[model samples]
Target: MATEVTTLVEETSAVKPNGGVTLPIYMDNHATTPVDPRVLEEMLPYFTGKFGNAASRNHSFGWAGEEAVETARERIAKLIGATTKEIVFTSGATESDNLAIKGVAEMYREKGNHIITAVTEHKAVLDTCKRLEKYGYRVTYLPVQKDGLVDLDDLKRAIDDKTILVTIMAANNEIGVLQPIAEIGKLCHEKGVIFHTDATQAVGKVPIDVAKQNLDLVSISAHKMYGPKGVGALYVRRKSPRVQLSPIIDGGGHERGMRSGTLNVAAGIPSACRVAR
Candidate 1:
């Protein structure tokens, strides 16, 4: 069955542009996937005719672009059991992970200076935690079991009154090990610590209901889910101790002031559209 799936993917992934690679990375789903032709069709017009800044609020072109972007947010949100208002568009999962981690660290600095995460987390996460460590924020890197699962007891012990956030990956990109994200989230909530999951490798492959899982923030990547690269989102919980974050790329106060800059109308819309379809 795996061989058959790989063969099918190879057949469709034939666009080796400029003698580059066209692999779908079947062996490792962390890389990228070919954009669906249908998704491309849905996105073409924005690049040509309807291209306008979503931040612009006084014209029809801008309105159309803004509408498309919002629709895409709704599509992406619905897939992961979140609301449209909770979605904050980003460059990709790396940025999402950074925003979720550093954002929490900065916003909650007065409340806590400690964070807990598994050693098996993605570099996007590990690196972000490292950046925080430089600023004197204490981080606890919980060791995983030999079987590549995080020890829940270790995580429970790591969380202290000074712990602000606990980030764990939903799935290991390298070894395909699924982590206990729901359990981790439940534990964090019990201790009044925010829970973040880098769900880039698990969003499309597994079921994720933010409410059910009690996730405070979720990092997602477009390319990891068979969509275009360079675009993703961070799901920030609203209400019930609403998650707050300091913007990393501050500019035009876009994306609820969590992420700033002009929205990528064409690519952003189809990336989420592909996953929803």
Candidate 2:
């Protein structure tokens, strides 16, 4: 059977009794977006009939939930040109940013103590890098061009033997300016410095192939692309140069031990994977 789903979003505001427009027309998609009804409907069953602990492997319900999660993982991996084992779910892009930056810093301290990022990056990224400064880690906040793009020449100059990681956002949330991610990725790989991109604003909005872009780590947010809130993912490359990170949250060792906790199966799995592709 073929099933088609549609989303009903109110684009225009209705007039009030006094003829004034509605307070918000929801044009601020850069901040957050409304949940698509189709996605909502798709996820409803998991909260009720399909409700089961994905970690519980002893019953049919658990098996079903776990199967859904694996399918979702496969879908997400396909969207980014990655293997299913590379995707790690997180609460949101903020958590993913923290994990990618802090995790790499902690794990690769022996390799180097320096990290590179741009000034136009999201607060989640900038703040994390700022916090690392207090921990004796040297961070180079590269200056972008007047058009809000990072300079490749400047990036080449910034890298050194002590440089461990380079994190740059794929798109500017405020201006919507796209960066030269492929070039940056190629440079980072050649220099042996791990590259991580905060792709919250760019994942679904633009084309991203982790393998083609030579990206080591990439962050994604479901809400940013009309899937769901409070759910996101982090892509960790596992081949050629295997990227390893210390767990920021420790508990049940979920998400392949990179992020340890009970998976937010309902929203995190299906909703996040439904996006980008």
Q: Score each candidate by Cα lDDT.
A: 0.87, 0.88
TM-score of 2: 0.91
| Cα lDDT of model 2 by residue, 1-277, tens digit | 1222222223234333454556445699989877777777878888898888878889999987888788878888888899989999899999999999999999999999999999999999999999999999999999989988999999999999999999999988999998999999999999999999999999877889998999999998888888778888999999978999998999888888888776666774455456546
Instruction: Give the TM-score (vs. native) of candidate 1.
Output: 0.89
Model 1: per-residue lDDT, tens digit, 61-115?
9999998898888888888888999999999999999999999999999998999
lDDT score for residue 105 of model 2: 99
In candidate 1, residue 222 scores what lDDT? 80
For model 2, name the residue pairs that clash: none
lDDT of 1: 0.87
Full-model lDDT, candidate 2: 0.88
lDDT (Cα, 0-100) at 140 in candidate 1: 95
Off by over 4 Å in 2: 1-24, 268-276
- On a 0 to 100 scale, what is the lDDT of residue 217 in model 2? 97
The per-prediction CA RMSD against the true structure, in angstroms, equals: 6.8, 6.0
